[model samples]
Target: MVAQDFIVDLNKPLVFQVGHLGEAYQEWVHQPIVSKEGPRFFESDFWEFLTRTVWWAVPLIWLPVVCWCISMSIRMGHSLPQISLMVVSGIFIWTLLEYTLHRFLFHIETKSYWGNTIHYLLHGCHHKHPMDGLRLVFPPTATAVLCLPFWNLVQLMSTPSITPALFGGGLLGYVIYDVTHYYLHHGQPSSEVPRNLKKYHLNHHFRIQNQGFGITSSLWDKVFGTLPQSKAAKKSR
Candidate 1:
């Protein structure tokens, strides 16, 4: 397909219109940057799609792969419900992975030489430019780099079939978690739950950097007992 120009009407939720297809897309709409809450930069449709479409599409890419896996698993003797369970299990596995990476890796305070360098390379850059498009999520190269080792490790004790099903599900979940984390930072939440999570995440960025460690959920913080306790203290005064 040829490249297309599109405009986003921020007033409408989650829709894009193609203006014209050309060598590249262009933006032809803009809205006033004013709101009851504060100033808002009404995003162009092209920009919104650029930000959102891939994240929306990622889990989709896994669906066919997962469906194939599920079908194969059933043919290989697993029940249909077990295949269904694999999908659900994949999501929960993603939660734990997301939590562990956020708490330990992203939040690791590096006082030494290489530690700080690696820390910044991995996440500090994102903290600095939370809005940078190219850096929104760890690129596929980075994902592959991190995923390969664990993928190999899982192979040591488990069947080859288990690896893809498990890893595909976990990777799908990671995509969701990573994109959700990005949205929590950059996109406006539609409901109270995400709004609250957004607030919790903002606190991680601005207020208490050490608290609100869980991005997908506060489950780990509650589980490990490291969740921030001082936000209320500051607010109650």
Candidate 2:
């Protein structure tokens, strides 16, 4: 199927239109379109609304949870220094998690109807509509659900005393990631770091989809050897 000059028919359900692409869906979905108008998912207004989220919504919904987790750690007798370390550790773990999830799960390839549909809703939509500001961050509901497994994994890895702070740290890391991601798409960075990040992320959307999965920083990408061979990287080296 021809990708250029293709436009999504916003009138009909987007799911069906995407499905109609069949094997061509993967190719079509990655062709970036700049639009703030989000595509419709469900017929119901409620479900469709849930798919779009603003950048600030991440901190608004999750900051309290992060604070609560940190408070719980304090109550459980963890020292301030220990808690600080754990919180930072959680954020560190989150950075790795960010890279891992983006590379493995979000970028997963599948050909089945449901697989494509689920993938589209999860991450493919962002690729197709990279500048849709509303879809830049993960919705709170979905993040809440995904938190369960990660929480359990943290518990399994460490004891309960440190879990609160550690988990809170990771959640904060996710928050930082979401905010950074939204900023990469919409914010103008006055400094060099964010400016570089914006260009790096845009390359992922517009140039190479399989490489450069790191968002908050490109540390993981370099370590994993998934770094984009963009001229910027070459020149920097």
Question: What TM-scores do the predictions have?
Answer: 0.66, 0.93
Q: Once model 1 is optimally superposed onto the true structure by TM-score, how far is the C-alpha of residue 175 displaced, in angstroms? A: 1.2
Number of backbone collisions per candidate? 1, 0
Please provide, for model 2 over 1-237, each residue's C-alpha lDDT reduced to its tens digit, 9 standing for 90 to 100: 543334558776686456555566788788877887766777878888888788899999999999999999999998899999999999999999999999999998866667778889989999988888888999999999999999999999889888989999999999999999999998999999889999999999988899999999999999999998978678999
Q: Summing lDDT over every window of 10 consecutive residues in candidate 1, give the lowest-scoring window.
A: 23-32
Clashing pairs in 2: none
Candidate 1: how many backbone clashes? 1
Model 2 global lDDT (CA atoms, 0 to 1): 0.88
lDDT of 1: 0.57
